[model samples]
Target: MSQITTTCPWVTNDPLYQQYHNKVWGRPVYDDRELFAKLCLDGQQAGLSWLTILKRQANYEELFFDFNPQEIALMTQDDVERLLLDTRIIRNRAKINSIIGNAKAYLAYSQNGANSFSQLLWSFVGGQPVINHFNVMAEVPAQTPESQAMSKALKKLGFNFVGPTICYAFMQAVGMVNDHLTSCPCYLESSAKK
Candidate 1:
């Protein structure tokens, strides 16, 4: 089968971006570790480009205990201090703190029988993907009411760095919503899946 190059300019041309685009970008990720990674990365990407965070993902994994919420939740102030000095990923103090804080919140949620981050997130969409038939990148929305509601709920549940825009990006990353342009190959491929 022939591949349709992505219509999203950010995903075109670059091999790494293209690989992520074709494989993981719009794919449903249910693993807790992966969900945490996406949430952390999306939060870190708040003031930066997605490509920037994508490039530093390996570093993030190394520094953040493989995005394991339980492990990250146990991190101490010394650990935060150590991460602050690392130049491999974004060195922002607030971002670093948010990662640790979010991990703690994740653990709390799990303890309360939330169980899976994927389950909690996907529930907002009724366990179905919000398929947007966008013909152009501009037609894609930055934030939706679903995201707004999610952001509010997450904050209420103690998660930080989870504003509406960031939540929307998280939703896109984890495939709770497929923002792929209609002409893109993965759009149809993703929609065709159960």
Candidate 2:
């Protein structure tokens, strides 16, 4: 008899995506650099599937200074143009520019006394992850009020490509919220951790 492996239905058998779903996605990350990187990667997923971006994430890390805001802020137009030719990442110019732009905005926020990108982001959930039990995938929403507020705040802070929908995905990805389907084996584990 063939045994079954249960996970979020959206996750396929691809190792990269499977690893992301099982080991990374829905796991809380509080590091400033990690949060910043996830936000930029989620932005790049706009109009594209997350799988498309996942395949190129290592390239993004290699090119984007591991998502360090200061280094990304220093990237020039020439750097972006050069990156556009690389196939290892999504070559969209607008997305590339948004990453550079968001890095600058992130730095400005981080420079505030006792403030950090992680703090700013975690503030949306009031320093706790919003745990939700959704029995089915359809029950999950595309955006929540918290995410809408986050998007507004990010835009006001001069970040781009951070719409409410994208913010919700970012939230789900980084464990600002627990969105695993209730029946998935990972749901309780994801909710229990961080």
Candidate 3:
């Protein structure tokens, strides 16, 4: 008989997905550039699956200058046109523009000096990760109050594609909230850190 392993219902048996789930998902990330990068990637996922974005992450980094807000903030229409010709990344004009726009927004928001982008983001979760004890996928919400607030704030800061649902997924990805199911090994590991 084979030993059984339990994981979040959303996870497939794919090794790459398994590695991301076990090592990266729900793990807290505080670096400013990394946070910015993840937010932009989540925005790219607005109309697509995350795996789609994940598969092209390296290409994104290459084209976007390693997610450097300063460099991306300077992207011009010419750059957008050139990127649109690339097949590795999604070719949506609106989506491509949003990343550049978001890079500008991120730079402006961080320059204001109210807080580090990480601090401002973490504030929405009371400066801690919100650990939920969900056993099934249905129990996880598409958007929460915190996500709504984050979406509103980001929009106010001139960010696009940061709707509440996308913000919620971003929160889960960056460990602002842990939406991992109790059956998943990572759930306990993540919750234990809180």
TM-scores for every candidate against the unseen true structure: 0.94, 0.95, 0.96
lDDT tens digits by residue: candidate 1, 1-52: 2265776665747777788888777787777767877888899998888888
Q: What is candidate 2's CA lDDT for residue 158?
A: 94
Instruction: Tell me which of candidates 1 and 2 scores higher on lDDT.
Output: 2
* Pairs of residues at least 3 apart in sequence or in different chains that clash in candidate 2: none
**How displaced is residue 21 in candidate 1, in Å?**
1.0
Which ranges in model 3 have alpha carbons more than 4 Å from their true place? 1-6
lDDT of each: 0.85, 0.90, 0.90
Model 3: number of clashes?
0
Global Cα lDDT for candidate 1: 0.85
Segments in model 1 whose C-alpha atoms lie over 4 Å from true places: 1-4
Q: What's the lDDT for residue 154 in model 2?
A: 98
